[model samples]
Target: MARYVEIDDVRVALAEPVEVPPRAFVGRDKELQLCRVAWGISSDGTELVDSSAPPLNFRLEGAPGLGKNEIVYEIARRLDMPLYIVQGHEEFTPEDLALLLTPDPEAVYGEVPPLTLRASPLATALYEGGLCFFDEINRVPDRALSPLASVLDGRQYIYSAMTGMNIGPRDSAARKRFRFCCALNPSLSNEGHVLPEYIEQRTLPVIEIDHPPFEDVHEIIRTSLSPSPDFLVAFTDWYYEQERQDISVRQAVALMNYAMNYEQHVGGQKTKIFDQVASFVVGRRS
Candidate 1:
């Protein structure tokens, strides 16, 4: 069900937060702590006492599939906050970041205006004091990101020219609780995908994320698929033998998952299935 909140004499329909997947999250202790500290969240999962200082907006810079999103999800889980996500792209506009106006389905005939104001995930998070994670933020162009400057800074509000409304938390408490984070592939920070200088300056404390260590990757695969020790041994050998470049956590998990599926449904011999899975994941060995 959609809920509405009145902001600046307009009824803004609140956007629901994306449901966090109930999956086993492993590793990234230091990166997770950096995010927590940026949000002013204590080690024990409580908000810090310094309400005077607003939380810093942080950015996760990494390659795609490196568990950047997972780190944010873990922080949200620990804080027990509603997480709203905005998937960045070239076409995202300023209005898309704040308010989206549409026709009202339930407006009475000649009684109320047909146009309805709908809040974006970012706006909803700002209003509700939740966490908003903008994924692949580098994909958004410079012109589309103008509104974020004020929101990222101490001003802490986004103004919508379409609705003529300033949308954000009205009180200090909600401002203290509101948090924003974004992730991007560092390789994309060139050509049309480069972040604006203002955005770069405001999204403080860039947290660089590389691929996890081999031990953590092993645990991640084990946790995701629960493969036998023999299967893992085979995987370890293959992993090093390839001397794979930029192998992400997602690819590692997918390798085991595809192997499991082959075992269950394809009725293949174990060794052959493992080889096929490896080829599918990392390309055939030269």
Candidate 2:
């Protein structure tokens, strides 16, 4: 059952505890342990005070599709913290971190001006001490990210050009208590943008996630396909070989599910299903 916590006297839902299927994640015991430790540091005030630690900020960096976001989702789940997601892109602006001009409910008449507004999504979430996930952090431009330096440092100061106001120190001490975590793609020649050095310096406890081992991959396939164990074993074995040749686990899962569904829809024959999967692996499908 979900639990509720009072934040600024407003109650928010804390998702119910659920069993984390071993298949969903494999290997990386050390990384999992580290995440758990960081979560404990953030959630338990007694532990934080004893260790003289502030909210643990983490930067999870890895190759694309390596389950970095999944780790963050799992951590949030285990900690029972409210999650707010922010997608970083070239168009993102400093206003994203500050206040946004949302529709005002207090506006009179059926017509409301777009100029009339409310707080930004991040600020609103932070006002309630919610966990904000900055997805693809490096994709956001350096100038756009400048405003977040203070916020990441646990200060909530934000300059709003729209209202010509600098609203923050929301409750003073607690204003500097929001937790920030981020995920970024590993810097590559093809990557779109680079994170500033200053922003890099502010991030702590950098964690890197690598692809799971072959056995773990097989387990993920099997567990995800538990309803059809026989087909799962065969499909996993076949995809395990494909993975050795550089196929992604995500593609493997997708192909397997597609093959199974195709078989069900057209005659329920294993031979036809295997052929469909093979075509997908070979990139022969139209």
> Could you say which candidate leads in lDDT?
1
Who wins the TM-score comparison? 1
Off by over 4 Å in 1: 46-51, 103-114, 267-272, 284-286
Whole-model lDDT values for every prediction: 0.84, 0.62
| Residue pairs clashing, model 2 | 100-120
lDDT of candidate 1 over 1-286, digit per residue (tens):
6789788777889889988877878888888888888878887655544656767899999988889998888777777789999999988898999899887756778776677888999989998888999999999978889999988987889989897889989576777778999999988885557888999998888999998999999999998789988678877876776676457888888887888777788767655566667777856646
Predictions: Cα RMSD each: 2.8, 5.9
Q: Write the per-residue lDDT of candidate 2 for residues 1-286, one digit (tens) a residue.
A: 3233443343333322223333355555677667656544444222222244565667888777667766766665655555667778878888777666554444467775334344554554466555667888888888988877776664565565555655454463444345577888886415647778878877768888776776766666666765377676666566554444344566556667777777778755563466556766546423
Candidate 1 accuracy as TM-score: 0.91
